[model samples]
Target: MSEHHEHRHPHGHEEHTQDVRAHRGHGPGRRFARWRHRLRHAVTPHTHDSSDKVDGALESSARGMRALWVSLAVLGVTAAAQAGIVVLSGSVALLGDTVHNAADALTAVPLGVAFVLGRRAASRRFTYGYGRAEDLAGIVIVLTIAASAVFAGWTAVNRLLDPRDMDHVGVVAAAAVVGFLGNEWVARYRIRVGRRIGSAALVADGLHARTDGFTSLAVLLSAAGAAIGWRYADPIVGLLITAAILLVLRDAAGEVFRRVMDAVDPALLGRAEDALRRVRGVREVGELRMRWIGHRLRAEVALVVDADLTVRQAHDIAVDAEHALLHAVPKLTAALVHADPAPAADGPDPHLALAHHMTA
Candidate 1:
């Protein structure tokens, strides 16, 4: 990726850096963009387009990758700043928050890998390509969130059992504010982009960041309380932060579990039905099935057609329905349309006996 980016600018080195940085974002952002370019180069294992059908899905993955990279940089800087405060102030609460920020930064690693893997072409052994890896990445993120909650709770309990002195109250307070501002900014940016791209995992990560911002506020309160000569406030605030983390954990776990079980929005099904009905020859839509493969949707639709229509005619109708569905449904990669003959009052049910969904 770095090599590719470098080749885009063959002019004078100084002017090239300034142009690329301006194109990316902030004027002085060239250094950071260059850093991200190098980081992108390190993680992207292989590059291949799955198919023209998945181009939209691939674009979503690309947006997700960019979000993860930017968030990682923000959180890393936030955690490092807090760590310096923790060392000088000897504040247990600030230390816990710093640890969590670090963990949140690392969670981006798996998601970044998943996005790269999703771009690979489908293989004989894995006909769906590597998109499911994003779901796996979601699982890793949920587990990471859970582990952070547990660690934070344990640390708070230990601190409560043996209270310790805290120094540099003003500095601790300043660091807490910095942490909160950084996380809140990241949370809003990630959630906004995630919704636009239809990525549940990225949205969950955004919620996670929002919760972390609240925890940082709790640390700020601890700093204030300690300055007022309240020794127990540090442990109490730490416990509150732990509770906040647990709340975030519950929501994140639910979303990850839903994706793992292949749950999808009912509204998406309605759109699929609407699309199929638009086809001229479809008599009655039936037994439609849909699932999310990562952020992408795939569907199998069954519908009734005129009993007098020949087999070729039914196939053509199915093809037209498939095309309609692909256009109507958001992020739909493939639609398997199975046409059935109109109901017959006589004899056995041949509809169930015949093989359906023949793809070229």
Candidate 2:
């Protein structure tokens, strides 16, 4: 996603405070204004160029696409190898793995496209940019992995209920070894690229590759067990592998769904709240709300500052609060700091007092 940053100057901090007062908008705009105000005052102009960031993201995206191609190729080769082993060994579990490998290949195409799209800029209508595409692609990958696991588990259950004679275990074991090595290579490369680009889609692709390696290891052990005279061991090992896949699926599904629904990470919210509370003039944080807009975190924070301070002082404190939240929580893209005056010498403001009582 594209990130916007404003110039900050210490002497012009007062001007920024006035501009924030003139802004009257919803949570998004107010949050943007708060960030702009703080950023416009806290730091001076820089001489360093930003072309490196753009180049790095693009290079990462390209690497992810290349890794996807390699994964796809390996999947096809592994699937063919498994098919040959299944035919020679007459093993239902091996046949199921063949199908799973083929399915993994199918997912690589869309995931590659998603990674590329995630690098693009946002249009006027799509202000958040294309980061959500990566999240959506991750969801698709998780679903496919879940389906493969369930299907493999079902096949293993049926095979366990009805025993069959399996042969050529050595061939199946050799194929599984090859698949494991291939998957390892893809997983390592894709994971590095994903982290570099900060692309969830590429990360999901890497996870899929790692899963393939585990699946291969399980299948290899099962083949060896079948050769060693424990006919039931093959299906048992297959079931165990399937169970592992299901566990990964559960976590991936929950994370992707949360992102899609704009859910805020609890740890991030807690950090933001803590930082704002620690600001110089802030007495407490009230009405704290936060969510994910694309890959960026946005927050709305209502805070109580000293009423004795001037408006400019309160605004400066609010700016500090916003800065604290953003700096303390790296993922927080924007924050809206609403400065509430504390109680007067005689008593609290009547409206604030009534609102506090109602809230309490």
Model number with the top TM-score = 1
Per-residue lDDT for 68-185 in model 2, tens only? 7876787777778778877787765566667767768688877777767767876898776676777778888888877768776887788789866667778878878877887777
RMSD of each: 14.7, 8.7
TM-score, per-candidate, Cα-based: 0.80, 0.67
- Global lDDT scores for all candidate models: 0.74, 0.67
* TM-score (C-alpha, index-matched) for candidate 1: 0.80
Residue 306 lDDT (model 2): 68
Collision count of model 1: 0
Cα displacement (Å) at residue 138, model 1: 0.9
Question: Which pairs, if any, clash in model 1?
Answer: none
Q: For candidate 1, lDDT tens digit of each residue in 1-360?
A: 000000000111111122222223445574676576456435643222344345556678889999988988999899999999888878766787898787777777887898899888789998978878878988888787777777767877887898877788899899999999999999898888877766677777887887778778887888888888987887788789889888888887888788889888899889778767766677888888888777777788787887777776677677666655655676666667777777778845654544565445
